[model samples]
Target chain A: MFPSRFDLVVAQTVAEAVEAKVDAGEGGRFLAGGQSLIPMMKMRVAFPETLIDINRIAGLDAIERSNGHLQVGALVRHADVVASDATFGAVAAAAPWVADPLVRNRGTMCGSVAHCDPEGDWNSVLLATGAEVIAQGPSGERSISIADFVDGAFTSTLGEDELVVGLRIPVPSGRSGGAYLKLERKIGDYATVAVASHLELDDSGAIAAAGLALTSVNPINTKVADAEALLVGQQPSEELFAEAAELAAAAAEPRDDVRGTAAWKRQVVRTYTKRGLAAAAQQAEGS
Target chain B: MEVNITINGSEHASDVEPRTLLVDHIRRTVGLTGTHVGCDTTSCGACTVLMDGTPVKACTVLAAQADGSEVTTVEGLKGADGLHPIQSAFTDDHGLQCGFCTPGMMLVGASLIAENPDPSDDEVRWAISGNLCRCTGYINIVKAIQTAAARVAESSNGS
Candidate 1:
């Protein structure tokens, strides 16, 4: 099926792209990899009058490690994330779990974050890893915390004129490690329920810090603060992981869908969260 | 819109609609039909092609997006007189039953071998994870990829 008619505007720079978007008003959108947006267009779910192609724009794909953050440019593809040293914690680990190789070849992590789909691959990882989105508009640029960036299902705090330029992820330091684990119906399917856990261990092998978040279990991918708090100052143990998993399950607000029932998803999240924590904790110990 | 794309070894410039998918452009414009569109959605890798030497789903990419870029379809996988190593391996291992998914499977397999010359069976399966083979139960497909990896390494070493 062919998509609806639209004018394609290729922008050479971020400033030009933002201006074109502002000019096109609500009917305009900045096209990145177009993995998500193109599918929507093909389904006639979205019909933008103007698609500002930013692929030609330079400088948005640089992976830089500076200022205690890993700045991943918006154009940096998911495949690059896994192979890049700049990405740390769950974002890198979850890269392979993203749709599949074909999609990951072009789908950018910032595009995933910008899409803000409830079942998106990057949300749980970004939320748990405390990543921030860098949005650039006519006025300049601003950073929005991932927790605040993803407002709801398929929604973000991005202004119509603002384009996601990049993502600044806080560099996890010290005995810190993160992992993303997902349960899907098939190889390339979206998550039935996914968990991203970042754990930091103390010198005594006790947990010093933890960040837990789950995807597709709520209106938005959300952090399990209570579950994370439960792991703090506690030694890593199967019992501790089980308790945190239960708490994480209780924090989840899964709804029934084709994947499974709400209760079933909650249980899935429970077990996956436990496994994710164990992986992260083990990495922390080795680090 | 006028878009220029380098397909296989040829360069083509064509006027296309913004909505025209790359797979359509490759098949219709360049007349290369080896790339199949099993599912227009990104879920199926049937339309997978190498864009700038990386595997990307053609249905999700617009012809306009491939402007000034290089695309390699399964048509480019063969040698001058015989089948490509991956294609040969597929035929030898009986990797396909219907042949609808074979092109994609072979192209993805080639990509996998290009990236990792000696992929394990698990690595081969992971490489073709996006591609679906409804026929042959995927056992032969995995065997085909592994065999192709060996052939590719052998060819490279001989050269």
Candidate 2:
């Protein structure tokens, strides 16, 4: 039912994909997994004159570790992340909770982040993991922290001519634990509200560092630094969790939509925040 | 645009519009209708197929995007003598009532079994979570996979 005309060009490399997009000019889009782009195209929300298929690009589907960081290629599928023994403990624990297995198999990690959907499951996790996004343009490659990479809802600092090449996640040190919790209205719908928490403990088993991010409650996934601050140096306790949850809820300015009301979202944020922090605390204890 | 893709281990070249979805290309040009399109959006896994050995929703993938890639549809699951073990298990275990979601279920199931020959009920559930089924309530589908896994293990041991 959607009508549009476009040329398809399969690019075998990142340079070729970029060149194709530049040559196509203002009306070109890169086709990765097409999990997000194709549906948007069918809905007529996004119409591009040319589609540069980047699936055949080599080295874009690998996941490896280097320099105390985990590097995931832009084209790595969510399923790949979920299945990998190296990254699966973190990614698998969260991936199956995404839309579904089919989408996970085709949806690329970079595509999800680049799409910058406010309710995306992985965005906040990426932020909580202290990941960096690598983008390649005509000039060269430049890396930006996830916090600086995403600007707002459905938007990023990425230039039109630039494409995301890969993501770099700093390896967690010491005793650290991370977890993602999302509240969805249905099985396949976007998260109405989500929380990602990372806690690192010192040798004394006291909280040394904490990272927390909330999604679907605002125009962008935001880290609740104040809440993280509330946990540092404190033992993981119900009272501390309640305090962090309260602070996190205060930080979020949720919207009222068909899925939920602002008040309900606030309640959920508070509830999920506590739960997520508690889980992160337990994970940190094990680490 | 003219795109060539290998479907079920055979390469087929066709002249298709850039807008043609891989699902449509397989159903129309390649004459394989086992893959069904359940939803316009990629939310449903009714059109699930193995693209380069990964189970993906064919509806979301454009035919042009699938160029030079190998795809496996449900119709390709059969062996020389009979149906694939999973297919026979689905039949013997009464995995389908309406059978609309059967192809996608089988494709996703085959992909799962291929990866993990012995999958737990939860693993099977997780594997086919993307493929939705209104009939059979997924109980028998899970049973079918369990049966297939046992059969596959038995055959492998026998051989």
Candidate 3:
């Protein structure tokens, strides 16, 4: 199916893009990798009267480490995140399971976050890492925490005039690492359930700082705060991990969809969170 | 919208809608139809093409977004007098059955070799995960990629 009629504006800067969007009114969209948007548009699930092409904007595709954080520009594709230098290690671990090579080559990390699909793999990891989203608008730029950026599935806290410019993630300060574990029905399919785990070990090999999140289990805001709280000051052991994983599963409020039943997803969340936590703990131990 | 795209090492100018997918432009405007569209969504690699030397789903990329960028389609993989080594490997290894997924497999296979000349069987499988082939059980597909990698390495070494 073809998309509805729309005009195009090539934006060389953020201001121009925002202005174009404002002029185009509520049906305006910022076209990035188009991996997610175009497909929806084709199916008539989404329609924009105008598209502000942000690909021409310079300085929006750089990945850098600065001021104790890793800064990923809005145009940084998943392939770039995988191949480029790591600001945080876990985003790369999740890259392999994000669609496939072709989609990875074109899909932008910021785009995925902006789409805010509850089933997206990046949200769990980004939320787990407490990644900050940077957006620019007529009123100037502002940063939204990943926790606050996503309001629900396909919804965000973004102002209609704002465009995501980059994402900032804190660099682990100690013996720390992260991992993204996903359960997909097929080799290339949306995850049934995914977990992102970040752990930092103290001098005694106990969990110092930990972050945990879940995706595809619905509610779009599936943070295991208690699960994370459970790991801190706790010894690294399979029994403890299982307890936290069970808590994470219990907290999930997923709906039954084509992916899986709510019960099945909860079980997956329980299992994968443990696996993700274990993987992160191992990496932290190695470091 | 007007687009001046550089595809297959040649620059061509055309008028396209802002909604025109790169795959359609490559097929309708430039008339290079080897790039198949198995899934209009980004799920299938049947529409894969190298945009600035990186494999991307052509069906998801807008022609306007691809303007001023270099693209290498399956048609561009042939040598002056014969099929590319990867294509030949497909024939020898029986990598294809229905042949619908061949172009994408060959193109992505070339990219895999370029990125990792001696990719392991697992690596080859992972690289083509975006593409789906219902024929040959993918055993020969993996073998074909391995064979192509060897031939490509041999040719480069000889050169």
Best by lDDT: 1
- The sequence of per-residue lDDT tens digits that candidate 2 reaches over residues A206-268 is 888888898898889988888888888988899999999999899889989998899999999
Candidate 3: which stretches are off by over 4 Å?
none
lDDT of 1 by residue, A71-145 (tens): 899899988887887776687789889988778889888888999999987888888877899999999999999
Scoring model 1 with DockQ, what do you get? 0.85
Scored by Cα lDDT, where does model 2 land?
Answer: 0.86
Residue-level lDDT tens digits of model 1 in B1-159: 999999987899899998899999999888999999888888878898999888888999999999999888999988897888899998899888999988888888888888898888888888888888777448999898889889878878899
Assess the local accuracy of residue B92 in candidate 3 as a C-alpha lDDT between 0 and 100.
Answer: 97
Instruction: Give candidate 3's error at residue B47 in angstroms.
Output: 1.4
Q: What is the DockQ of candidate 2?
A: 0.68
Model 2, residue A58: C-alpha shift (Å): 1.1
- Across residues A1-287, which tens digit of lDDT does each residue of candidate 3 receive? 55777888999998999999888889899999888899998888889999888998999889888888989998998888888776565776887788778888888999999999998888888888889999998889999999899898899999999999999988888899789988888876888888889988889988888899988876685778998898899988999999999899888877788887998889888888888888888888888
Chain B TM, every candidate = 0.95, 0.96, 0.95
Give the per-residue lDDT digits (tens) of candidate 2, residues B115-137. Answer: 78899999998788777888746
Worst 10 residues of 1 chain A by lDDT: A83-92
* Ranking according to lDDT, highest score first: 1, 3, 2
- How accurately is candidate 3 docked according to DockQ? 0.78
